[model samples]
Target: MRKLKKCLLVFISSLAIVLISYGVLFYFNFFQEFVTVKDNKVQWNNLPDDTFKSCYAPKLSFSSMPVTEISQTSINLLGNPVNNIKVLEKAQRYYIPLKSICTVLGFSLVKNNSEFILTKDNMNYILSNTDCIINGQSYSLRGNLIFYENKEYISISDIEYIFNLVADFDMNNKVISLLTPLSNSNKSENELTDGKVALIRLEDFSAESVLLSESGQMKFKIIGNYLNSQGIKYHIAWVPRYKSPSNNIDNDLLSNISIENVGFINTLDYLINHGGQVGLHGYSHQAGNNTSISGIELSHKYNSSEEATRSVLENAIDTASALNIPCTFFESPHYKATSKQKEVIKEYFQYLYEPNSILTFHKIQRENNNLFIPTPLGYVDNLDVSSIEKGLAHPTPGELASLFYHPYKELNFINFSKENFGVKVDYSSSSPLQQIVTSINRYNYRTIHVSDLKN
Candidate 1:
């Protein structure tokens, strides 16, 4: 018994010494925090041992497109910009401050020692270091409590389960969206896809551009093959570039272009037969009798009133019917249409995929009134192709994966500056197919036609 008591005393003394030593080391900054972030490698180093600790980081990367940081991308807190709300990345996980979440989500955090309470709609949320206690029950979580720079942060994963919100992390675009329950199920009877996708690619098919030479035919074949390879039942918006040309027939050298009406119809027939959903872009894609915006045919063409827009649209429909082509939907030339024109269009057409916002037009509204499906991915305006991924900045579901390319790129083409769309571009390599595939995979788009996205 005496020997056993002596052993216990020694063990207790040793444990006390170890504890004191640790406290001293911690007090003197001996266990300093060193964080190292490298490509696909994130480490946390501490002093005394000086050993780097590896974290469980899942491989999250985007292919073919550049990886933008979260800070660089805009995060929507409840579909509005909340400057106070911020996200922090550490240990390969995202953390949001408790205050920011409360402020943005319209809740108050009741603070307690080692725990915080949130009461909203009569239910109480008790958040601790490891569990989110609701009422009297505790739910387990990983990295639920984080302290950085003396401020408390909760894992983004916990926000939805605790706050009745949805957290969408766009891996490709690196944007985060914390949305209300309404933002997730914001679908009318006509708003197409359940969530996964509904694909629509605008062909910029203009009456100004429907030429049927060997090059034109070959380019169409290429687009068809690309779509087939992607297994995308692609729907194309047919822009009727049907302006009466006076002296613009400088295609003597280019066999890809001809003023012959027969070849153009033949090409249209080919598109129709090959799974093309016909839609009028405009009756004429030239802003006739207007000097303010020259090429915006639908915006200022024939007239600004609804009747003229209706007349031009009806002309296109009549032309489609006369040619035995299906005139199902309408898209604006350059997504340029006034509210009055859109009203006229929605009256006649079953659906119209219009731009939420374009480069030149910033004031365009993107409300999903069910008639105007917001065109998310606008025109693929650059040669790098991946530049179009900017549309994923606000990654929402059921949006029209609307993208268009000028077939003129197949020939010697024009390039635009990164900033200005109106300025002409001289040279840029064409990689439209690569960008399209990247975007499709990144967003998990299920291709469909405008008419197909019905109740």
Candidate 2:
């Protein structure tokens, strides 16, 4: 009986030891699955299989389209999975080549011959460095192969190279990538850092008028104060003077002699004297659609059908020269800009402020690499201030709000009779200007000025 008991004890002890060893080995070999969401799309781990599942199907816009299957492992990234897939498909269908996934995610890419790096989730990755220490791993340069009907094909070697270089990486520190388009590298270093831009601009001052009214000058003063407080750097643009349709309305006959009378030449002098900038605001606040003046005449004040567009731009340059402030930035009158207007402006102004955006007031121009900053001012007819108030209350990141008003609007409403401008009408509910001020304070918003732009 004693011998049998001893044998049983030994057997039990051996079994326990074997079990513990197996557990440790399994733990060491296992990899936990993780999900990544980016660009409004989701991706799940198929690290072992190279397969991805779509977390959500798109709202089919085309009839007879193939049904998309959803995979349980898929993730929802950037809150818009449907749009993300569409962008991916567009890239594939159009054969439009791109470098890294980071670009699609709206982040820049960087690399070094010896080390590969990227920044995502505010965390940085550096591969092929001693810190990563994956030199001994048998990493393979696998392409982004798309498999259809059991056959695979791929040509995106750059992406494959990045994956191979970092496949064995154990992220420990953060780093910024240095790779970028050649044109982007030419931008001032300060402009690229922090990825923030500041603009200073003026409205409606012209070559003919020199006075800074409370409405016009006050706006710039407030902007300067805000920018100084924020410790932000900025560029400035000058308002050029031109003849408006209402320009000929004699001051004596004009009932609303607002500063739309302010000429561009005078506007430039004031901006320069007041530590503001001088940029083109067209020769005149020209309006109208396809019949509008071309770029050359718009800039230089010359009427030429042979070079109507170029003439507008030349006139603008001439006007700028006349004001003693050369300008390459333009803001359309009253946000009334058409699509081709930019192509016209691009001939002279490197930056353009036009009225063609749904969300952003300022946008980086898509083609020219020149800043296509939209002046984010919304049109307020006083009745719709409530909706505007709500949006201001919950402003998005990088949101910019510009308030443009004809000083004459106030003058006309008040009927001060400063000048016999025209027949006047009136209403109550506080002026749109007053509502704008109240909303700004309520939202605790930062006000940017037209004159505070960076040249």
Candidate 3:
């Protein structure tokens, strides 16, 4: 009996030691495995020691200001100067009169006690002091609500934020230039006479790769010059950084748009000057060792957290802002992202260039304040025009026919012929892209900027 008791105690001690070791290993994540993609193969490895310690810091922050009085200011609504519109200056921030601005925007503003209700079409905004409800969604105003001289006032930034309009405030001149789709004073009514519109997007333009080469520069100029001559405004899906997946060296894989890439920047500037708008197209367009342009960046497979998503977006936005390029819209790499990731995207951009789904395309879908512009015609793959023509065949009045094409493909299509090897490619009538645009024009579809379709 004594020997059996001693043996039993030893066994209990051994079992406790094993159990405690297992718990400690799990607590330290020794058993946890993480995936590292290499050469298109998935490799599982133990979590790194500093994995938990590293976290992405937020790149954006907002500062609140107190209300203060200052000088009167004038306003410009789509280049037309407005007179007698009293603007309030609060803590160096300009606040436009809600009633007066609403009147200019053709929106009806009604006051009930301390609250003001602004309505236009399907949009509704209820402003009560520092709180605002837009389209049934509530938001706290960064600039405090002020009542000056028997009229309610909202900050210039707030006006842009709430109404989805672009507001540029010139502090020195005390002039606020407001641009909205609502204002059609600058547009000819006959442009979209049939109510058919089309948006052209050039995809995957980055600082690195062939786009910076001499041939690449010519191709870009060809496309830009052609679009300008056709009176067509388009969007460029710009990737701020290019990461080549096949390259193992860190320095070789990553390329940024900086002063070093002067030639590329100049080409971009030329495009922008000729009615080309830049749209954010992911930071690297790849996660880990996956491919760029083809790989998914903001899906559950990679950026699972909102913090990670915001960090990626901020990086892209900051990169473009550094080069003085404006990113008014966002297009996810390969148009792949989770719903949660898209929600975070909405916090930054007012427009998203994508479709409702793979099957549903042809209309602009609105989510809260962000607009999801669809690409109904898809892309021209290997110079195939069948898909594009099929999309152009059917048109509903007021419907949008949007599509994207890679400028690099133009090089292949235009230069593949031996006869045209050394000759300059004229994009006006020779290229398939020009043909697609001509088809869109033939269909009575007026080419318009993405912002013009906000209404």
Candidate 4:
């Protein structure tokens, strides 16, 4: 009996030792494996010492690549870290299942390429090697085929394309719909004829934005030259009352301009002398955002103000009298006009630049018995190719290029004297406007300003 007890104790001690060793190995992730597969061959990179420092093993598994695969150029459904390739060359390019690759890299299938590149901010990524090279450094990857099911595959270009679609999200208030060409529409009976496009501007309410202001001037000059070169007529979005009190370059430009300049005394004189027009933007260009405005809404929406709320019209009329220009046209600041504001605005001005919220001219009469022509204006807040493309792709055709813009590097009386910086105001480079100009010139487009209408 003594001998038997000693043997049993020895066996128990051996079992305990084995269990302890297994536990320690598992804790250090010594069993963890990294996987990589290519051309029917599977390879793995050994896990780093830190991967399994705890008790849990990483969940590693694989899923079969179902669809047919093509050459290395073909995208694998499993996407990046592709471990397998199933060749099916005849499949339509769109049907290639490369969700993994597309989802990882944000690209689309507009064109074909051997390898796709991802560039965001300053980071650069190359998908072929399953390596993330950032700032000239490579980070080793641990997994093979980024396994999903019992089967493993690579992502590569296929996944990159899908991600491209996701990143190109469209979020904006603008909508495009086809309408009859201007030639088919009835002309406006007023001084400013209907069907004639107009160029309107928002007075940069902030005085601190001088860079933006100079930028705006450069934009204005560019647009003006384009219109003039094309022989297209246009009108300026001027607020005489908003002019700087100083006799600076801005004032001189305003005083010498031939089109409608928004203001009080000088505007009235210009209108009287040049057979020009006067429009009401707002008193002090108003103040507010989506809500909180005390004035007649220039947009089609109704306002809650007594003068549509703030008696904005009363203030506007008073300002006009003070400045000497009769307010005949109404435009919303930032294009945020309300219904009540519209009704009240009509009491002061004879016409209003149509708001985009109204889909068609027919829709305008349904909203208000008055005439609201659809005069679309391009709203540019920044210098970009996309913005310029929008202007050209959808110009008013034969009407004015009523482009609305704001340029202010800083508000106040200074900064306009500074050079336009390195930013090319003219279309000497690959500017969209230049592209449009080249296109229109090639096609022979005749441009005209709104004030040039014969009505």
> Best candidate per lDDT, number?
3
Error of 4 at 371 (Å): 3.8
Q: For model 3, how does the per-residue alpha-carbon lDDT over 262-365 read when each residue is reduced to its tens digit?
A: 34654675566456888889888888887677767887888879889987898876566444466678888877878888877777776788864533355566
- Better by TM-score, candidate 3 or 2: 3
What ordering of candidates by TM-score runs from best to worst? 3, 1, 2, 4
TM-score of each: 0.45, 0.36, 0.54, 0.35
Indicate the TM-score of model 3: 0.54
lDDT of 4 by residue, 72-125 (tens): 333222223323434231111112233333343443322125333555555555
Ranking by lDDT: 3, 1, 2, 4
Give a tens-digit lDDT track for model 2, residues 294-378: 2222322333233565454555565444323535457754444445555555555545655345433433223333345564445
lDDT of 3: 0.64
lDDT of each: 0.50, 0.36, 0.64, 0.34
- Model 1 clashing residue pairs (backbone): 205-239, 206-241, 207-240, 207-241, 207-242, 208-241, 415-425
- Candidate 2 residue 48 Cα shift, in angstroms, is 40
Between which residue pairs do clashes occur in model 3?
none
Residue 86, candidate 2: Cα error in Å is 72
RMSD of each: 32.2, 31.7, 18.7, 35.0
Best by the TM-score measure: 3
> What is the Å distance of residue 102 in model 1 from its true position?
74
Q: Candidate 3: where is the Cα deviation over 4 Å?
A: 1-194, 248-260, 357-360, 396-399, 413-425
Q: What is the Å distance of residue 49 in model 2 from its true position?
A: 42
